[model samples]
Target: MEKYLMKSKAMHYVFVIIGTILMAVSINLVYEPLGMVTGGITGLAIVIKELTGFIIKGGIPLWVTNIILNIPLIICAVYILGKKLLLHTLFATLCLSAALALVPSVNILPEDYLLAAVFGGALGGVGLGMIFVASASTGGTDLLAMLIHRFKPYYSIPRILIVIDGFVVAVGAMVFGISKTLYAIIAVYITTKVSDGILEGLKFAKMAYVISDSYDEIAKAIMEKLERGVTGVYAKGMYSDKDKKMLFCVVSKKEIVDLTELVSEIDPKAFIIVSDVREVMGEGFIEYKQ
Candidate 1:
């Protein structure tokens, strides 16, 4: 057990290191040079950096301000997201801060606003996605989202993040002008798109929850034809006040259409909910070998 715990901690550290590098590359190579303000503390940093040149005489610098902004959020995460999450987030945030401070300045993109916005957003989005997959974050609005999620699990965290970012972009517009605002919007869009793509790319399985009168037939078919396993969960219908069997299964996307069709043919009244699962570890799923 101690060995496993140490291994897990080591993996988290590895993720933090990798996530930090990607984030630094995105910020230094793309966002900062273009002045594209993204969401989160990084975005706020860009806004501040623009207003005041990156010149610090004494005390904490603008870069430090970005790190400090996450302090309150980190405390909240510690209470809400648990100790492991708190440590991972703190490590990831510190790595990001250090990377931004240490990476030698470089200008990769031309002064063209369009290129800057597009590439910067894409890079930042990929970095964010990687950070999420690592189960760590660079803090900022993500901490707020986690806190909000603790209170309202049903609320859409990404949507809330968008709203927060939108406000930041609005402020950037006021200070930087409308043109930069437009570029920032473009950058935000790209970041979202790329982040989603990266997350989806990391998905390993699909979870299917099936509600059907022909539960037996579906289960048999899944076992015999798909060579997949199924677990029957006893469910009580709210409106019908009748007990029913619901089938839960995880399968590859290759079998999704076939599964749907088999269910539809077996019971036209069947209800099926399919969702992408990022990672699954257990019987019939990806399992780590000892």
Candidate 2:
């Protein structure tokens, strides 16, 4: 058990490092040049740096400001959340702060705000998503969300994040001007969606439930050809007051055609309901988290 925990800790470190690097690169290389200040502690730091052009001999670096703000928030999380979470968040935030300090800012897509927003947001989102899956955050609004969720389970995490980040972005508009602020909004939206896609699994699939008289034959066909598991659920038709076999199956989006055709061929009037499944975890899909 100790060894397993050690391995998990090592993996968490890996996630923190990679995610930190990705975020640092995105922020430095892409967003900074375009002045796309998507809301966060980092974004607030950028605003402050721009506002105070040489207060302490030179303007404060983003990482320095990020750490300055995050310390109190991290302490709050330590008290509110727990030590394990605090450790992960601290590691991730420190790595991110270091990377931002050490890494040079360069403009790969110079003068193209749209391009910067697109790629920068995507890369940042990927980084954020990895950290999220590892059960840690880079502090800032993430930690704030946790603190809020602890007191009010009524408010969802996403809503809390939006409310917090939205306020920052609103303030950012004053610093970055309207044009850059608009681009920043675009970048922030893309970042949220891409990160959600990453954590949820980009390789989307479909979940289907079918009710038909020939469910047995369809199930056998699905199992044999698709090699996907099919569960038989006892279902009753409310309108007709008749009992029927309901087939619950999951398959890749590509297999939907074949499965539907097979069902149609087997039963001409099969009642089928198809729904979107953001993720799947089972014997065939991702293993359940320990």
Q: By lDDT, who's the top model here?
A: 2
Q: lDDT per residue, candidate 2, 1-290, as tens digits?
A: 11122256677788779988999999989876667788889888878778777676446789989999999999878877899998889888899999999889778888888888898888998888777767788999878976887899786444566668888888888878888888888888888887777655676789999999888899999999889999999988899999988999999888988999989999989988998887776777665656
lDDT of candidate model 1 versus the reference: 0.75
What is candidate 2's TM-score against the reference?
Answer: 0.90
**Candidate 2 minimal-lDDT segment of 10 residues:** 1-10
lDDT of 1 by residue, 1-290 (tens): 11222356576677567767777777777766666666678778777776656454332343586788989889877877899888778888888888888874477876777888877777777777667656677788867766776788676455556678898888877767788779878888887777665654544688899998889999999899889999999999999999999999999878888889888988989999999876666766655555
TM-score for predicted model 1 compared with the true structure: 0.68
lDDT of each candidate versus the true structure: 0.75, 0.83
Instruction: Measure candidate 2: CA RMSD.
Output: 3.0
